[model samples]
Target: MLSLFLVALASASLLPGGSEVWLARQWCQEPAPLALWAVATAGNTLGSLINVALGRYARHFQGRRWFPASPQGLARGERWYRRFGEWSLLLAWAPVVGDPLTVLAGVFRLAWWRTTLWLLVAKGGRYALVLWLADAWLAPYC
Candidate 1:
């Protein structure tokens, strides 16, 4: 469970990892669907929260040489945020776009409760889907 949680957390962050594979393996071994799903959801959501914190504070470092994004990139992000608004958070479970969206949410200083609610739904729904697919594809093998 801890391994799943950690993997989910790390994968949800900017870090590079794939939690779905690990989750499927764990599901095969333990067969504890609910606990695994909940742990993965919680950990992934927490990791996204970390990105939110980084986004909240990222403006402070914009003038620094080491800041990751260029001024133009930041402006583009702001524009994207304005266009999509928080509704884009529904895609927060997507591979390439999800993590950054969380950060954008923080950069825009969106309401935390609303952000968290969206994250929980998105992340939890993702794990649920992954679990369902695992059960469908690997059930006989397991």
Candidate 2:
């Protein structure tokens, strides 16, 4: 449990790792899907919160080419923010665009509660879907 929690936390942070793969492997080992789900969701959500804070405070560093919000990501995130407004946060758990979206939310200074609510929903859904797919289709094979 501790390992899973740490792994999930690390994966969700600005670091590079895949929490879904970690969660799946741990679920297979311990058979505690719910616990794994909670840990992964909580960790990923917290990480995204950090991204929001970074967006809130790191605007000065945006000139750099490799800031957390890359140039392309900033443009795409801006479009999403402009087009969908706060509702675009529902994709906060997406791969290519999700992490930057969280930062964009903060850059736009969106309401914190709304951001967190949608972020939790998206991240939780992702972790749940991973477990569901594994249980429904992979279990029999394993």
Candidate 3:
């Protein structure tokens, strides 16, 4: 469970990891599905919160030489956030865009409760789907 939690956390952050694969493997092992899903969701949500913190403070350094994003890029991100609003957090489970979306939520100062709610739903739903698929795929062999 700790390993699952860690993997989920890292996967949701800027770090590289694959929690879905870990969860699927754990699905065939001990511990209940509910526990696994909850742990993964919680960990992923916590990881996203890290991104939110980074986004919140990162703006202070936007124009510095060390800052990653250019002025135009930051402006573009702000525009995108304004256009989509906080509701776009529902896609927080997606691969490429999800991490950035979480950061964007922080950048725009979306309500913490709402951001977390969306993250829990999306992350939990993703793990549930993974578990379902794992069960179906492994049924023949078991």
Candidate 4:
């Protein structure tokens, strides 16, 4: 359980991949889907919070060439933000664009609670859907 949380945490941060794979494996082995879901959701949410904090703090250093946020990436995220408004944070679970959206929300000083709510819905829904699909996929074999 702790491993799942930590793994989900690592994946949730700026790192790639997601907790889904870890989640499905745990579900199949132990069937503790609820506990696993909670851990993964909390860990992933905390990770996004980290990005939010980073974006909030980075307001000062964004223009610096040494900053890790790439210019192109920021530009793209900004465009997305402009197009969708803060609601774009709802897609925070999406790959490629998702991480940047979280940071962008922070950069814009968006309401953290709103972003978090969207994230919870998206991330939690994703886990539930993945679990359902996993069961469906693995059912016939098992």
Best by TM-score: 1
Candidate 4 residues 1-142, lDDT tens each?
A: 8888888777767988658888888888777667878888888888887888888888778789898667788777667766685777667778888788787778867777887888888778777787788788975654
lDDT of 4 at 74: 72
Model 3: worst 10 consecutive residues (lDDT sum): 133-142
Q: Model 4 residue 107 lDDT?
A: 81
Candidates ranked, most accurate by TM-score first: 1, 3, 4, 2
The per-prediction CA RMSD against the true structure, in angstroms, equals 2.3, 4.2, 2.3, 3.6
Overall local distance difference test of candidate 2: 0.80
TM per candidate: 0.87, 0.79, 0.85, 0.81
Tell me the spans in candidate 4 whose CA falls farther than 4 Å from its real position. Answer: 62-83, 140-142
What is the RMSD, in Å, between candidate 1 and the native fold over all Cα?
2.3
Model 3, span 1-142: residue lDDT tens: 9999999999999888899989877877753788888898899999998888877887888779998888988788778777786777888889899998888888777778888888888888888888788778965654
Q: Please say which candidate is ahead in TM-score: 3 or 4.
A: 3
lDDT of 4 at 129: 80
| Each prediction's whole-model lDDT (CA) | 0.91, 0.80, 0.84, 0.79
lDDT top scorer: 1
Off by over 4 Å in 2: 60-83
> Which has the higher lDDT value, candidate number 1 or candidate number 3?
1
In candidate 3, how many clashes are counted? 0
